[model samples]
Target: MAQPPPATMRAIAIRDGGWRFEEVPVPVPGPDQVLVRTHAAALNRADLLVLDGSYTVNPALAAREQPIAGMDGMGEVAAVGKRVPTTSVGDRVMYMATSAFADFIAIDHRLLMPVPLTLSAVQAAATPSAAITEYDALIVQGGLREGQHVLVLGAATGVGVLATQIAHYAGAATVIGSSTDPVKRTRLDRYGVHVAIDTRRPDWAATVLDATGGHGADLVIDHLGGNALVQALSATAVGGTIVHLGHLAGRHAEIDLDQLGRRRVRLIGSTFRTRTREELFAIAAETASALRPALTEGAIAPAVDRVFPFSQAEYAAAYLTSGQAFGKVVLDFA
Candidate 1:
């Protein structure tokens, strides 16, 4: 453990239904936890849900009475609890934790991943949650195989970019991506997306089928749910898998179950919030290990769109909502 820590530190606080920066008490690490001085934090769409109170994090685990919002960050281990054995003080680390929109965060040491020297704090902060989500969806759940035709729906989002790269590295025969943004769609080719389809077109599924020579995608990772999910069924080949990971399109949609049944397509819904702490730690560690080679070789890296200072969290959130960012938006405390 380090010497006695400060009484309070600067943090992005949610008060009166809005975001504001304030000084809050520095959290004490529990027996199994470590105190991190966060250098950079990344925002996710879920953060907006949390802000609007649509997605409730366990109140018992809330960082303060009002709760702070953020999912993952990169920082230095400033202090270790008496029973925390894995991380030492002064270590550079990154981890997914609740209430990370602050200058400091106290998290379970088990969830931590050592930051690779090659990655800047911004790059490392951009990983963790996004990496784990893609690893689970494409590798563990989707069983994406080499030479398989894969389609990434909503491939302009943060997780979408990572999924495209992962599928390419997995040796997919054709990596197709769908995005509503015309400019982003064009850049998808630079990120391992072999074919970029405009989701605005009602016949994008037909285009995907044509790209695969009338054989639909072997794996369809759907980030847009609702009507888009129904369309994904049309893009999936018989016996293929469609991983429904996001509902950005909406929650409900009308679809033909007969088509789903006849095609023998498997639809899976995955979310990290439901995983046990131990399970999440395993996923994080495994993803880090699996991507180390790619990370070291420059085959995979964070596509950071913009960075905002800790005090400008409101502007950052607004920028994310503007939908101009093609990659992860980060909040830098340094």
Candidate 2:
């Protein structure tokens, strides 16, 4: 059934550093693109960064009166462009990118991944951003190997949780996680963490070392930069890898150069902005393929802490900023 989309659809618009619903023209897919009618979307740390003007938006989009927001979405293919070979109208899918806060989005078909039947629209929407990030950090960049010990800093975060799972699935001998919240720390094992340490403790690194039998971790996924980064460096084993994916704690840090040099640490910084469109498409394709089995078999899942109505995006953003939620906060368009 070919259904004609309305001329305009509601979108969460960024205005005066906040979000509000506004009407925007429904986009038509270009060649090699697909038109999606979104049913759900998820919030990310980038969303907060963008909303606060800390992260720059696309120049052309920033010039708009009301630029759309969001990075992950689940939807049905309402239309497929002429050059799109793999996608067809009516297939359920999920994707990762900005400007997904809109009701309908036209995006490159190559970026779309088939939504597994076991997941709901909200769960599907929650997967792309968190999954791709962890896959890139833990597996691709960090080079986690079977039987190696791994540590996930800020383990209560949505990305942190996924990173732990990826490490576990990769056959890590031990998985250590850190969280400031005791309640959140208690839930880390469910995400495949063998030990959860309170990051607030001054002796947190000692606990991690004890858990790993004083060998330190083979790989460290550091979401918190600043002091946490310094601590993570200390916890990393000689010749180990530490992938710095976020600076949620603080941007600036004074690290020990002598120690870093002695440890032979491979510190890698990663972000979506550094990748070109073609590169992102490739990463999306690779990540989707690698995780499809786990996703389809119900072995891995995104931990959604709360789901808000699409119209209540403002509330959702506030909730995300509160830091009370344990997992991804999603917007339900249903």
Candidate 3:
């Protein structure tokens, strides 16, 4: 039998204008929630934004005295609420939820996904947010079809690596990825990128067009916005879709409306920040269903760049900010 949870837990939270460990009350599961004893948590760019007060998905977090600073984690189910029948104590699970930088999280059972047997706790923690984001961007929003040409900007990023792999697993004919760093560009091929373009080159779009035999990409999963987005318009095939997932380069972009209209291109912006609980549940369900086979078989896995002990979370965040990691940065609690 599992031991009862403690009254309080250590969590990384915003305090004194920076991230610090704080003792907070352990959350009690509601009727539909599950209490997970987290073993690992994955750091995302959004965590940085949350710390800096630039963005927040949960408005209530801002009003809290010490807002936690994580988005996803993996652990064992310590307890379950009355209404959550599908999950039980001892189930290994992963989920995307607010306040996940703590040792325990009480999340809706519907939000939890069983960790694939092939993955360790840390790898499982790395998968949920990136996998779900790309599955939605590539399959749902971009309308990816088998034999299509797919392009991913910032392909060395945590989500970018998964986007490339997801496109490849979906049977894309060509997977082209871009990274400004040549060193990172070289690493993309192992992650399912058939052609790696150095975005630093002025003619990178031409390279993409050439690689596609002058046709351009059928679907572009763009992580870099600003000038990169504008250039993507020129590299996109007629009727292609561009799903803008992030703006790591620059947020503002001057698009060429004439080119967009002539090409009949579809530009879409996606984020989980504004989604309702029901909408997120549906997305999580769809993502799990579509990617479970690959996940279970180890055909698709998160590329974990580094693992930091939970105590070194500050260094992990700094490492991620330095652009030194090729994939997801994870914080291991054990």
The Cα error of candidate 1 at residue 286, in Å, is 1.5
Candidate order by decreasing TM-score: 3, 2, 1
Q: Which candidate tops lDDT?
A: 3
Best by TM-score: 3
lDDT of each: 0.86, 0.87, 0.90
Q: Which ten residues in a row have the lowest lDDT in candidate 3?
A: 57-66
Steric collisions counted per model: 0, 0, 0
Q: Which stretches of candidate 2 lie over 4 Å from their true place?
A: 57-66
Model 3 agreement with the true structure over 45-151: per-residue lDDT tens digits: 99888766777665422212347778879999999999997898999999888778899888888888888889999899999999999999999899999999999
TM-score of each: 0.95, 0.96, 0.97
lDDT tens string, model 2, 32-128? 7889999999998889898777886543222123478998899999988999998988999999866789889888888888898998999999999
- Model 2 weakest lDDT span, ten residues long: 57-66
Q: What lDDT, from 0 to 1, does candidate 1 have?
A: 0.86
lDDT of 1 by residue, 116-167 (tens): 7888999999987777788789999999888999999989898899899889
Model 1 quality (TM-score): 0.95
